[model samples]
Target: MDEFLKWYFSHNPVAAASLGAEGYDHTLGDLTASGWQTREREQVQWLDRLSAAEAPSLDDAIDRDLVLSQLRGSIALASWPEWRRDPAVYLSTIFAAMYTPFQRRLKPEAELVESALSRLAEVPGVLAACRANLDPDLAAPLLVTRGLGQARTGRNLLTRTIPAMVEDAELRARLAEAAEPAARAFDDLVAFLEGFECGGTWRMGEKLYSTLLREREMLGYGAAELHAKGQAAWSELDARMRAVAVGVNGGDDWRAAMESLMDDHPPTLADMRAEYEAETRRAREFVRERDLVTFADGEECEVLPSAEYTRPVLAVAHYLAPPPLSASRRGIFFVPYTPDDFTPEQVRQRLRTNSRAQMPSIAVHEAYPGHHWHLSYMAGNPRTVRKVFRTPYFTEGWALYVEKLLHEQGYFDTPATELAHLDCRIFRAARIVVDTALHCEDMTVEEAETFMSTKASLSPGTAQGEVSRYCAWPTQAPSYLTGAIEIDRIRESFQGTPKEFHDRIAGSGGLPLGLAEQVALA
Candidate 1:
């Protein structure tokens, strides 16, 4: 296991850096054809080795299964044309490679600065590899469009956000010097993408999509069944949201109530961040007072503005978990403020979606007892495989589950806040419908956007961005509600208090729902 992990981290340095593995901070992964071939071959060998070995204990068995699932998922998708089609794959890798060192302060400033410089020097080569690997004839039009936007954002991150993050004058100067050429590499990528005649599709279709859910996520349901389930869940949540809306505003129109709530947001982005920080603190205290779950020693979370590159997809807010292997377990809850370049109407729409009534639920979901809290416990687990491999089925499901848990405990007891919380769930249910439809049910990108806009009640721009993300990442959108439902089932069979249940499930790490069920039942 140790040998395989060392090889894994060396080839996938960005993932290694994210996991807090040392010795990969200054490097980026190889994105060329040879790199992929080597990784695929090694993964198959490791899978075979692990499969032939007998487990010494339940923990060993679980770890062995976890690694096997990851390896199988990788091997299953090895034939997919992502490297040859998706420009975002390479661009996202470059951004994450440069961004991770800046996000985590585990290393000294000087060392981190040097690491950034080293990664900066590799930007051109990585982009060159991208140019070599990508076939314009196979490129997905939507992905190429999104990739261009990401390239622009990467340029902004290198020139603006990152340089300002360095505190020391000399280090800032050194960073700026290295960042200049890196920014130009992004410009070159933008130029290449602009000149391409990309007309490929993004759909994974029924077979590969079902394989992802079954083999990778370890789910029993196929794409069609999951789509039906999503439809049913969305209908149920819609009814509940309408009933709650009637109580909040003396009407059964949930959309009107949501709009009213949106009008109650902070007047400015700075104020929004302040409110989120305060709400995060309050949620933490409530969890401690209620003894909701155990917080790992030194677990801390800070609310901050989102980086420029992330603002496109993560429009409202998202969480970044701490490196499980690092001493610092502080997470970051990022709120993406409306970009200055947006039209006046766009700014209003963005702020409205991130309204004041929704702040408590958002805080709980992304911080306190949501991602930060859950991931902190996962980070403290002794098993390295558990720490390294995370399925969205468990992680996203746990985050969504806590939202309801807190609401049931009277944390979001007010009518408006309760409605806001339900709104969040409704959105997740809608994700199931859209995600399956887009990849498996032949739903067009435009149709998915409209479903989100009308059915989910998202703004058109937000809906468009959300649909694009679903196109890029199949099977993840439905994980929020699907995981929550699975967790609820596990809780029903468990003979323990809420804290024990929460801790047991979370401490099991982000396993597939099937494994998580085993842990919970045990």
Candidate 2:
């Protein structure tokens, strides 16, 4: 079952790239109409088989808890969006994963470029299939994301940053050629959306949205439940942030303290890199002190500038996977580095935006206790499905949970650090409201941006981008909070238990929520 699950997920181009699976490297040739039809047909049939053959009693017999959840999630992923080309459901393929290939020499960039170029031709076919196969007249909520498949596919082409991933002169030449067609394919997709789909989009509808909530909630938490908690969490965080908002009179305020530590906000790119390295070192020390999450003794991380081209879309800071599983045990926290000469103010802000007091707390979210630690832990876990199955809510939730854990255990005790924690809380709290607001409520993108900038103290640019991301990805924002809250609930549920959180579940930690429940609640 483990090997089979790996086969299944490895076939998914999204997981393949993000997980760095070797065999399924070519996503382009596979995205065709016949190709999609075959896969979809196979998936539908597979679900029917599983739903009919089993009574879901396997969870009782499945010794590994993570495997149990994978078996369960497999059933959900099989039905998945009901349309292979539905961009809204499938955009996670583009935006959330697949960065390492574009930014680092994780693998041969030419292969990546070729794979992306091939995918360009298949986008239109998939979109057409969505129109042809999915009920066109259906409508209720967010567009099902048809008609924009090609454009969405194009979003990942990323020619501008190809140079960062590869330095070979010949490869550079190939990249120059690849970038144009790749960008053009996606640009065309965007143009098509502007003209055709934006106004009269085919909505996957509320029913599907509800289903999405179910599939995720089963792994994370329920939607209405998440929505309510998100609201409550925001209110709680706002109060905390306001409490910490000591007005800055030069050096006195928490915000000013953050600024001073960031080298008066790094007037130069070199300064920003220095700050990032300093922060990365700070993270290493923090983890070492607490033994928070398992950090391999030999694991070393550095903070480097994000390639100028990729920085905008990346988290203010991100983890680059260790090269190809063979090169190193370490991952670099790729901090965004805008050229000081290119955009001084923007560079400074980009540099300062993430590492500032609040941002390092996010480091716990994205780096140590977050994606990196989880990825490393899960990737190495013995369970087969563990490597393939990614429950974003559970993983994101754990990281978010740990940010507060740091404070709870005295990781962030300084007034400045505490305020940073508050800011992180504020932003996440804002996420709870804004995620639902963009997807389910009447607010415009501008409204969402304003809410974050003013309330969370985000820059206007950051706010706008975040709102766009929230809009493009439905129900995801709430997950960080929802997952965090769920982890908290799980912890409280087992509060006085003698078993360690890691011990009861033991090595089954890589598995997501469904598995967590068995051990956590036991």
Candidate 3:
């Protein structure tokens, strides 16, 4: 297991660095076609070795199964042609390679600077590999457009964000010096993608989507069953949201109520950040007073404005988990308020998405007793595999689950807040349907955007951003509800209090839903 893990981390260096593994911070993994083929062949050998090995205990058995599942999923998806079809694979890798070291700041100042410089030097080669590997004629048009935007963002990160983040005069100077070539590399990528013709479809289709659910996620059902489940969930949540909206607004028109709530937002982006910070503190205090779960020692979270580079796709907000193996466990919750470049109407729409009524639920979901809290527990897990291996099924599901848990605990102070929580839930439920239909059924990207806007009641801008994410990332959108349902089911069968159940499940780290059930119910 140790040997295999070492090989795995070395081949997936960006993931390794994100998980706080050393010796990989300065390097991106091999991005060439041959490197991918080599890794695929090596994964088969490891799978055989793992299958042949005996687990000495329950933890060992679980760890082995976790590793095996990941290997099998990777092997299954290897033939999907993402390397040729998706340019974001390389672009995202570049972003993470630069962003992780800067964001984590776990190492010393000089060491961090050195690592950044080394990674910046390697950027041109990685982009070269991307150009060599990606087939423009086979590229998905939607992804191509998205990738072009991300490449521009990458340039902004290199030329602007990182320099501004550095306070040391010498280090800032060093970064600015090295960042020039890397920014140019991004410019090259942007030009390449701009000239390329893209005519491919983004859908993974039913067969691969099924493999994602069953093989990758270890779910019991296939896409059809999951889609049906999503449809049912959406119907129930919609009815509940309407009922809640009637109580809040004296009418059953939930869309009107939701829109009204949007108007009650902070006047400025700085004010929005302040509101989120306060709400996060309030949610944490409530959880502590209620004794909902155990908080890890030295765990900390910061609420901040989303980086300019991330606002393009991140839409409203996102949470960045701390590296599990690092000395610091300070997570960041980023609120993406409208940037200065946005039009007046675009700003209004973006602010509406981050309204005051929504802030409490967003804080609860992204901060207290949600991702920041749940992931802090995950970071403390003594097992390396448990720390590094995460499925969105568990992580996102736990986040979504805690939103309801807090509501039950009377965290929401008003009918408006309650409606906001339900609105968030319904959005996740809608995600299940949209994600399934977009990949498995005949839902176009435009159609998915419309479903999100009309059915989920998201702003048109937010809806477009959400649909783009679903297209780029299949199987992930459904994990929020799927994992929550599994967790809720486990809770029903557990012989303990809510706090005890929460502690046990979250402390076990981000296991797959199936394995999470086994551990939580043990």
What does candidate 3's lDDT look like per residue over 118-235, in tens digits?
A: 8889899899888898876677888888888778777778978887777798898999889999899989999998987878778888998988789778998989999999999989
**Between prediction 1 and prediction 2, which has the larger TM-score?**
1
Expressed as tens digits, the lDDT of each residue in 1-522 for candidate 2 is 544455465457655655556655555234444655566566555444444443345443333333344444444544443343244433334433334555445556667666645554454444444334443333212343332432443444355454345666776666556556546655655564454432323222344445666653464444455567767876776666545545332333444444544443555656666765776566657865766555544555656766443444443555665532243445667766543243556655565665455556766766665566555554455444445555666766777777877788776766666777777776777887777656555467678888887666566766766775675556667667667766777777785542256334323443456666665665
**What does the lDDT read for residue 260 in candidate 3?**
91
Worst 10 residues of 1 by lDDT: 307-316
Model 3 quality (TM-score): 0.98
For each candidate, how many residue pairs have backbone atoms clashing (under 3 Å)? 0, 3, 0
Candidate 3: which pairs clash?
Answer: none
Considering lDDT, which of the candidate structures 2 and 3 is the better prediction for this target?
3
Which pairs of residues have clashing backbones in candidate 2? 144-203, 144-204, 217-221
Q: Write the per-residue lDDT of candidate 1 for residues 411-482, one digit (tens) a residue.
A: 987889999999999999999999999987568888988998888758898888899999988888999999
